[model samples]
Target: MNPSRRGLILGAGAASLAGPTLAQTDGLVLNGRFVQGGFAMGRAAPRAIVFVNGEALTTASAAGLFVVGFDRDAPPYVDIEVHAGNSVGGRVARRTLTVAPGSFPSTRINGLPQSTVEPSDPALLARIQQEIALKTEGFASRADADDFRSGFAWPLDAYRVTSRWGSQRVLNGTPARPHYGIDLAAPAGSPIRAPADGIVTFARPGMHFEGGLTLIDHGQGLITAYLHQSRIEVLPTQRVARGTIIGRVGATGRATGPHLCWRMKWRDRNCDPSLLIGQNAPENS
Candidate 1:
């Protein structure tokens, strides 16, 4: 049986997406925020397929739940097409996604470990490079199921945010990749829960910079990572339910204090974790 049509109204005026006013479609519904570095959950008729910005997307759930996201340097707009499920020939619904612009703050830090801010030694550089390769291979998405449709939650029950996504990292006045994750300050032994249902892909005790880390694949190229963990309770390839304890927060590797760096990546693009499940979400979801 087709599920009842239920979703958030994301029209120009009804939405708080902070983007260009977009026209609404009759049957398409979206929740979450719509902006650069942001992600949203969408709903369509059952068995419906979707395409966003010319890229084919698999629905996040069997009930036609899907996701749309914008990159850090995404354009102002994107095109979306939803092929609705109907008894007869299905209808096509097309809509434009207006991605709002965002600004990143730059910070300059002087005091840091020599190996951290810059790894001048050949051995250390080699180790860092190997770690990067390991991460890239481990995080390669495997979206065989719609595990993420269950929704998201905070890793730490009681925590404070220390840093935000898209912050410029000026290490010793030299530019580096912008910080792409939200840093949550928690005690070293603070338990961390899985924000959503996913399969653990990478769970290891140490990395060059991340220290102990874990990656959970949530289908359709959507993966969430937990960094600076003091302990990883789950093993690779293990399925975990939402709210399951996956690890514990810690100050490891290149970190300054005890914290968990929560990050989300959709395909090859990094997205803001806060937008997907933070204050910016519609209805604070």
Candidate 2:
């Protein structure tokens, strides 16, 4: 239940969760990895209010289950503040999270559809904006499901990691957003399983950018998305367990070949899917 009290830590990356007791600072317990593009789960006194990154936007569960997320380009240090006890001016157990950097490699590809790489058509631009809004609304709500606490798995049985998180990408020699998801190379129509327990938030087919896309809510602001699928077997609001076949991999949307693009998002920040699996994935992943 209480992750911090139990001293349980998740995420296989370049960061470690501090022990249960701060000792020199206070009696707060925190767990979870600290690498860029990942998340950390922290627990404290039930009555304590937690502030992350100097913002009061983070909400702790009634059991004091608060989660912090780092983006792909997250800063080297993050500030965390905990207001413990009932005292008016409680101790500011503010801690700066030392984030471990993730090495990224640059990739270049030429001879792609210019419109697909960079939408120049007015109608297509409107569609792209609309799709982005729709995708954003997909995971806007937070849930109480504890599936993410368990961990994740590879959607495919075995595959090569052709791309990694935050890798530089140049489409037709024009720079674009760094890749944010891991690419699992598989044949078209290959089964894609759910990596962890979650509820399907949105499943749409043939969008302009992501093609067949599905968003699974794993609770506590933890979510994962399946992009560029040939087929989606799950529907919105459906509950799925780890290893369940949720879709079929394929070359859809703007992709170059058949593969599954798996992405993770914690609250509003992006996270590397590999970190949450509790094991070190291949370097290309």
Candidate 3:
């Protein structure tokens, strides 16, 4: 059989078969947890085949365990398929996963008074829409996983972490969106840096929702956003090396205090920023 056709057939069968039963066949058993934009798998058969929502992922070695992430957000339930083939025979297995929404952290503002202003003021809403468009247009590219793995850097100087990625949040006794990025608490004038080498795409001050925002486009459809800044030091279309100072943290636009809300996106998929930073990693440019 042609390798591509064989792969498809194996994938289809794997999608319907149980891991253990497939193991009894010529294929290896595969198990994993699936979530929006990310997955974790273990004890896969050596040289096993893997597919997520019908998309094939590159496996680097014959190790039975692997992980995969996507550049798009997936709904709650996702399908996973796997197959393992050797000279003698192969097996296929399929499973379903229910992904939970990521949690965001709560940040307490020390000196701001409670505001009575309506959050839905027409002028504010329009400006927010414009900003979202700019951000969306800036990140609308598709790149494979290899493009992101080249190297990762901290976008800003390491400071005391005010909030962590994926922490649950409650605003004023009401549940709000989960915190998507790691927050670094620094002085209002503390300089903010880029996490990786990329081109500046969007740099604007006080549009509507975001007070001072800067966005960078890393090649292959990856982008980072810096929001609620007190100052923007870079201009749109400027090329920045990793760790370059682009702005300073501040309480701008709907914020209660001075802090930086650094966010990362792979196309439309929001991802955790902490995963890309490691100890003693070079502060690239």
Candidate 4:
């Protein structure tokens, strides 16, 4: 068979095992299907847990089984671990997996400086704790799933990318961590728009690390966050349309200059925002 035809057959075979199926002994790939089914130990009520690269994933149940999609831009060879949590406590109870590369388009990130912190200061630690809490809260239950799947657009126009997502950084010449969001270099007071239709979940001015921040729930556990804004034009619980002007760019909190940091999350799993925009999004809007 031709290479393209062989790949199509393989993809079809993988998709056929949609419901409870056998787990691959090797790795899972982004946008790829695999059979990951079994009973997990430790919970009195039997709660399912999934993790990718040590980060827990929020899974959705369907047809007597659970299914999950890897982040569209996840790195190659991610480890997937499953466990069950209960009222007693949590324990690791399943297999470890390695993820391979699939057919998703690759993204090239640019323009971020390397920086790091010891994370030793009490204040900084506390702030980190707070941010963690916010992320872990999950998406709003009322969010509609159809809205997010419809499509997305660029949230801003005429801006240069100051930082791209997934860039490993060295803070103070020491390796720190990877950047998780795409930052747009815009002057303070420049309009920042919404990428999709959603309801505002958070709108707070001047947080410990994020400066002014707004989080919009785009349904189906998908959320978009805007950080380091100089002004917030939306309110909590407010419904916003795609392309709505929700805020303005600014240097807020720990940032050194005015910029818009755009972030996307599926539950707690972070994904790159650039993958959702059209080719003409930056140039036309």
Candidate 5:
């Protein structure tokens, strides 16, 4: 890797992936959290084609920048490849990385309305399905901008973490899917800010599970979602900069208390939002 280029740094509390120190290549530099539910930013020769597991996930930016993410249930090892130049004097670099599994704890929450935990009403179930479909469209937004290069910040000035990413959740004595978002406990109506520059792809004031849901596309399939909001201030196609107030925290959805469920996604892969705090995007040499 080039000595002048820098990659993202994870927060102090983020779990670091354990692995052997693999040799770095000068042709392509990569860095960031490498564990399951983590993220990584990369830099390669300008116009170079990058691939993960033989599939071209993304092409490098004009400045040779790009990003990738690991899902919550990502496998133990990942394969990366970069190809540059043509048939004459071409350059290729390959790297195999060992990723660490997420250490999630079992969490049990009682006293919630049984309907919220496992809705039995056919009408309510249909509404939930519609809401999920809307969110799916929001996650599909992919703008050709580099707004993520500005990096991310905490959405709230101060809050307590009530639930972490990838936690095994048991609600109302029924085991549920692992939580994919970080739940920040804040007073109702607390201001929520945009974590990075991005264009709003979806914003609705009402949803069965995610009240006042909102999603922002930070370019190249990197999207962030805010759930259980008391108020939604932005609209679809709106552009917002970091620290811009976008909404207010609340318990309007299935939540038992006032809080914000913050989530991040790189394409379809879910990632840890807390890991991006205070991290800067990678730059070319």
Candidate 6:
């Protein structure tokens, strides 16, 4: 792939950081936030092959659109390469991107039960492990559609942000894993809508940590999860349109109060769903 043929397309929002060096190439273009925990949308020739840092992505669509995600702890640089046409004699395009590191703050949360912080019951731990395995299968979904092309909207019509993503969480005086979801504080029974078109991959109630959880696959391994719901209206394998009500918020699970833990994953990378709100990938030029 030639380095001179790569391009990036950025929209008009905070998600569109100004760092990508767009080239004069015409066939392949990518657009999105060039920061850690952000995602990018791209378009290439139909059936084109895309590789990020030498790993093959889940193949391009018939329309040539694709999406790439930067992990929360992603390195400062990324390399994107596209191969159009057949491998024997195809046009190659490449771009070395600069990814900005995220600035995460420490979040202290107290007044939690001791068992939740440090579980000692063997049976409870085993159940937690089983739940983790089920969630893993949900995150591994990679439907071959660019459903994200419709862009994203806020899941809740009215809510207050209680916790932002990528915060170092300290629960009850003990440091824990970094929080990866944006906590939306809303009244119990407040409806949560689908941010984009997707297929429901997992929906279950009464998990240990997450009392109620619903995961939606927004195509190409980009999945969004809703946690601590009071009522789940959808089921696994169901197709939901954007703005459809999937569930209602609640204070179930380990939460301190009524809220919705909104999380997103693009393949193995955890990205900030807030960045994609009101942002759509630029159309092919």
- Model 2, TM vs. native: 0.83
- Return the lDDT, model 5, position 191: 97
List RMSD in Å for every model shown: 6.1, 6.6, 10.6, 10.3, 5.4, 5.1
TM-score per candidate, chains pooled: 0.82, 0.83, 0.60, 0.61, 0.88, 0.91
Worst 10 residues of 5 by lDDT: 2-11
Query: What is the full ranking by lDDT, best candidate first?
Result: 6, 5, 2, 1, 3, 4
Query: Highest TM-score, which number?
Result: 6
Model 1, 1-285: lDDT tens per residue?
111111233454344443322335456666555567876666666667777776666543456666766778988777777777632247766666556677778866566576787789998888888888889977786566666565678889989987778888887677879988888998789999988888898898778688899999877668888998988899988999988999898887778889999998887788886665532212111
Candidate 4, residue 235: CA error in Å?
Answer: 1.5
Better of 4 and 5 by TM-score: 5
How does model 2 fare in lDDT? 0.74
Error of 4 at 79 (Å): 14
Error of 6 at 220 (Å): 0.8
Q: Quick one: RMSD of model 1?
A: 6.1
The candidate 3 region of ten consecutive residues with least summed lDDT is 1-10
* Candidate 5 lDDT score at position 4: 13
Native-referenced Cα lDDT, model 5 = 0.79
Q: Which lDDT values do the candidates have, in the order given? A: 0.73, 0.74, 0.56, 0.55, 0.79, 0.83
Q: Best lDDT goes to which candidate? A: 6
Query: Tens-digit lDDT track for model 2 on 1-285?
Result: 322222222223222344432222354555555667876666555456667777765545556556677888889877777776633377656566666676779988777678889788899999999998989899795776557656688888877898888788999999998988988898899999998888999999998878899999887667899899999999999999999999999888888898999998887888888777753211110
Judged by lDDT against the true structure, how good is candidate 3? 0.56
What tens-digit string does per-residue lDDT give for candidate 4 at 7-76?
1111321322222222333222122232111111111112445555576654322111222334545443
Query: Cα miss at 27, model 3 (Å)?
Result: 19
In angstroms, give how far residue 224 of model 3 lies from its true place.
Answer: 1.1
Query: How should the candidates be ordered by TM-score, best one leading?
Result: 6, 5, 2, 1, 4, 3
Model 3 stretches astray by more than 4 angstroms = 1-52, 55-118, 141-147, 279-285
